[model samples]
Target chain A: MYPNNLKYSKEHEWVDLESKKIGITHYAQESLGDVVFVELPEVGAEFEVGDSLGVVESVKAVSDVYSPVSGKVTAVNEALLDNPELINQDPYGEGWIVEMEITGGEEDLLSAEEYERLIKEE
Target chain B: MSQLKRTPLYENHVKAGAKIVDFAGFAMPVQYTGIIEEHNTVRNQAGLFDVSHMGEIEIKGKDAGKFIQKLITNNLEKIEPEKVLYSPVCYEDGGTVDDLLVYCHNWEHFWLVVNASNTEKDLDWFNKHLKDEQVTIENISDNIALLALQGPRAQEILQLLTTFDLNEIRPFRFKSIDIAGVDCLVSRTGYTGEDGFEIYLASDKACFIWETLLEKGKGYGLAPIGLGARDTLRFEAGLPLYGHELSPEITPLEAGLGFFVDLKSEHDFIGRKALEEQRAQGIPRKKVGLEMLERGIPREGYPVQKDGKEIGYITSGSPSPTLGKHLGMALIQSSEAEIGNEVEVIIRNRAVKAQIIKTPFYKKEDK
Candidate 1:
């Protein structure tokens, strides 16, 4: 399901402005197939725009999940440690990776419509 | 660029919604519904594999038997008519050229089924070494299509249509059978480490047999398995693939395939002298099975470390579905290949703890 108000990254990461929570999109999880393991960033780990946050290892290969905006990791989805399949089942909802306090301009992020076009061009 | 080859079931794989990938220069299915699902289906019931990409060579002449005996490591003299033998073709230096299945139809005629990637090279080897002999080595890879029906329930499903008494067929033996009016060579051999059959038929008739087997085997829970599950299953069984465990630089002795090499047969094969010398001196590297005590899975090409230093490398690895543990096969220095020996595998630039274990990681009960 596509969220109208959230900004999205080219790498299929979605961010909600209201809660400042970030997670992978449904399209991203679908393309990656089954999610077996997820390596999450530690709390208080600061990242700049386009920084490597963590990795998501699927059955096929490992993919590096990148940060969309500059922020510090305030909270992480620890449930992924026991149930990585949650990302495949609901990537956009409860599968959110981290809740961060946005420290940079939100204008740098692309709108959901722009991200849809970006994935279409691929 | 070399052109990609397609098997007779290429369109069929596409129609089945398979993820196509280039494997050994052939466009083949890597997965369909899912790897784990297909793998479990084959283990529990039966699965059909499109193996047309494998190379088939027909050797026919008066001295075919003697010629093959000189070329391969196995004791071909023990192989009877209508039986097959699995052996490794070695180089003059005792390094493995390829592991292949040799079928003896009679004294004057034989067939060799080799890995798909080594088709051209194997053909060249046969031609150059035959040395203007009376024997003819024809590359029949394009003309023949192969399918493997593998698992516990394979026999029950296959016996429904064929008139032949499959129960009489012993392991590693084959016979010419008529399936749906098509003449096919059905062999009681497979790579899945299961009681199964590998059926070889004319390329034109492959589709007919494939559809027929699928339809007939539906009651037996037969699924169209892809290459992904095939790899996982074979890996769990501790079977070596060509490019992985057995390479041109690695000998059969080092690869733990010495059982297939008839060293005591008193036959002078091509690599006999080199192999004898190597056997006496002891191999430099030995292939061993590794099981992770740590969390991470050691993948192929990952360096195996000992006391923070590299000693060997992992050849194949995956999470073993049967054992529910991360398992791997590695080629390590002979000095460090002892059982229960502590080792480390570099995963994501970090050395994870592992231990050397015995092979055949998952053994099946006698059916």
Candidate 2:
């Protein structure tokens, strides 16, 4: 089950509104396989919702990590530089990818129950 | 849209929780547990792979040897019966049709194992060039199933079911033997750059053989590997994959597969003239090994640059599980491809520094 009380995007990204933390969901990490490298956006960068923010390289393929909400990038996770497998080990806690100041309010985001329902439908 | 094809081991892949992807129109397992794990398993211990999708062609005729010599680039006259020879099946323009293994059963019969994606095209090419040739070509891709058990411990695990001496089949040699009392063709050859065997049996018995191997090989740290690890294993060993390293537009010379081409052979073969001409004129571009100087794992189709000018492109690349480093092979101008020369690879729109290194990032220790 996905963590509750977090806004979820259909793209399998989760946001903790209180701390402005964002990371890919457990389902995303599972589907992506073992993460070999993580390329994060520099702090102070601005992006619209659903913008391509960075990339995650796995042993098999490279995938773009998209921003789920519009925001000004405040901090990017540096822990993943040396230990990208943190995303696979703990997708929600130690795997948080970025912190941002919300410039555009949450819109069309789903709750945990809705996100779980959506994934089941897939 | 057409439906994706599945091998006889499709059900087994699903039961094992494999991540299936569409590879060359076939729904194949790209990874099971994980790519890095499965890759290391083959490097240190042993691993099993479902290579049933590879196409096999059987040639039965009095002129089978002559027919083979005319088609592929490698010389078959010197290849002994019961031995296997690797060849780059080339086109008239010197471009590679596919890199395949020719199993010389005898003068009257030969077997060709070709790339699965190139099966239809290869068959068409073979038939088109018959030109009154006295040989019968049969497509056995669907009837035959293949499983490769590879690693240092491969012999011990496979010896459990067969009483025949596995040592009889030397590297690049094959023997028609019985396993678990079932008739099968066993070959002492593998693509993983390790000591192993390739078992070719009836399609119906594929699942049974696969399960049996996994069950018998469990104690030896054998795991079911997928295409993800398969690519990594072959890349680390500097073996060329058909589409990535050799293709219709990529010549064997540029791919560094000339050893298998037999350019100086007396036999007249397809693509011989073109390759000879290319060799005399000096190959413009060639393949070289690359080790990442900066961070970032290089991926295929990415550009390679020298002094900010695009010079080449990565043919095959990944995080080498065995070497524990980011490395790749690139096709660049022969002049710029010298070993130890520095080049930059474009990874995710950023240029990452990489140095050309000696090929074959990993090699198996001699027995």
Candidate with best TM-score: 2
In the range B108-134, model 2's lDDT, one tens digit per residue, is 899999999999999999999997778
lDDT of 1 by residue, B1-367 (tens): 1377899999999999998889999999988887777888888899999999999999999989888988899899879999999999999999888999999999999999999999999998888789655788999999999999999999998898789999877999999998878999999998887889999999999999999999999988998999888988888888899999998889999999988888997888888889889999988899999999987777889999999988999998887765777889999999999999999999888889999999888777895
Candidate 2 local lDDT, A1-122, one digit each (tens): 49887999998889988899899989888888999989899999998889988888788768887788899999999999989999999988899999999887587788999999999987
Residue B62 of model 2 has an lDDT of 84
Go through the candidates in order and give each one's C-alpha lDDT.
0.89, 0.91
Task: Tell me the spans in candidate 1 whose CA falls farther than 4 Å from its real position.
Answer: A1-6, A104-113, A120-122, B1-3
DockQ score, prediction 2? 0.89
Clashing pairs in 2: none
Q: In model 2 chain B, where is the ten-residue run with the lowest total lDDT?
A: B257-266
